[model samples]
Target chain A: MILRLGADFLVAVLFSLWAGRPGWPGFVIGLAIGFVIVSTSDLAFGRPNHGRRLLWMIHFAGYFLAILIRANLQIAREILTPGFNQTPRIVRYPVQDLDDLQVTVLANCITLTPGTLVVDASEDGRWLYVHCMYAEDRAKAVNGLQKLDDRLRREVFSW
Target chain B: MDTVRDVITVILLGSGLSFMLIGAWGVVRLPDAYHRLHASSKCSTLGLFGMLAGAVVYIGTVDALIKAALTLLFTVVATPVGSHILAKAAHSRGLRQWDHTLSDELADDQRDGPPQV
Candidate 1:
């Protein structure tokens, strides 16, 4: 944990330098910010394989960016064109295996993606009620969400 | 180099403005609140990011770039969460879906009691 904190501090200092503050004061500030971030995260989530986690985070970010852009374009088309191709409905998605943090991340990802927004979670957190804009075929809509869930489970949370 | 930067900025700003316009139009055009939220949240997020990217590019300063990047990051994390909460509240309060909606599984689940473990 201490090693991770040190590494994070160094990276933060480097970031400060890259951000155009070239001085001892910037380094001190960076170290302070880094300490706060690292400690807070450590408190939230226990120590894990940092290198593997960072790699998966990068992977997730790239995949998420592509989908995010696609979602924007899809909405733009819906707006620019004359009529709507929307078949909105709410579906109950099972979230049985995921813990709280994983569920939160999954919910946010679903909301940000194309045509899906998380409406609520069941009292037990076993299911997420999702509002899907394009649900003409219920199975397909569920399948799309299932795919995202599988990827997140495999890539990010497997550690 | 300067010309390239200017052109990029123009493109970014133009796209961002158009996206914001479309989001506004969608809110006016869509059938219901839920659908409107989709348009407003998604488009505005991309629109804001585009404008921020333009600012970062135009300024070409470390401070400006970092600030813009931080704003983008926060928006990326916050926008969806905010929209989710709003949508959840709307659903719980029985905000109506569009008339043409195909199914209502969530309503069914709510009415039928919680699912079996």
Candidate 2:
């Protein structure tokens, strides 16, 4: 809850600064408004484990950028070349122990990465169906997803 | 230092535009909805990041820099969720893949009545 409030305060201050009023008074006002909204929302939806998530956010930002750059370059190369060698396939990724939020985060990470799109999650949220543009080596792709899931579970959920 | 910043800004802007163009090309050329989402989401997110970085360099104000950073963060977090939803919706609607699709584990799961996960 405290971390969420801090994040909200940061956003509010940034917004105020972006609005061309970068002063302490504006920032204080923004912080107050942010606190109210964040507190109420936290009340409605159970408070997030924000400290772990904040740490994960920092770690994931760097990791995400590295992957994003590589994926962008790969897709750009594929697009520029002729006769793309994509072997698209859908793979079922098991999500046995993680809760819904973890599964959702894992799924989003999969979609954000190039060459993979999370097509669906089972109603029970125990499985994520991911479509891979390069699926010639299915086991390798699933292994990659597994590694990402493990990292997220470790860093974000500490599970 | 100013000249260096200008050069960096140009490079970032050019790369960002190039990624966006590539994403547009992929949208047109990709064979299926899911494939298009794969291309569009990654490319656009990276493109926006690049462009925003360029803007931050060019503006060189604390406020502008903070805003750009926020935009990039939000984009990184939000784009995947947007793509995930679109892909899920397309799949649930029974959107067909390209004729050459190599595997369909989800379809198989439907037939087999959900595997023991």
What are the TM-scores, per candidate, against the unseen true structure? 0.83, 0.80
The alpha-carbon deviation from the true structure for residue B21 of candidate 1, after best TM-score superposition, in angstroms, is: 1.5
Give the lowest summed-lDDT range of ten residues in model 2 chain A: A48-57
Q: How well does candidate 1 reproduce the true complex, by DockQ?
A: 0.60
Tens-digit per-residue lDDT, B1-117, candidate 2: 999999999999999999999999999987778778888999999899889989988987657876897898788779888888887777778998898899999989877868773
Instruction: Please provide, for model 2 over A1-159, each residue's C-alpha lDDT reduced to its tens digit, 9 standing for 90 to 100.
Output: 346757787777776777677765666677777767776776678766444566676897789788889888888888889886889889998888878777777777877776788888888878889888888999998988888777777776662
C-alpha RMSD (angstroms) for model 2: 5.5
Q: Which lDDT tens digits does candidate 1 get at residues B1-117?
A: 999999999999998898889889999998888888888888888899889989888987656866797799798789888888888788889987788988877789889987797
Task: At residue B7, give the lDDT of candidate 2.
Answer: 100
Model 2's CAPRI class is medium
Candidate 2 has a TM-score of: 0.80
Count of clashes in candidate 2 = 0
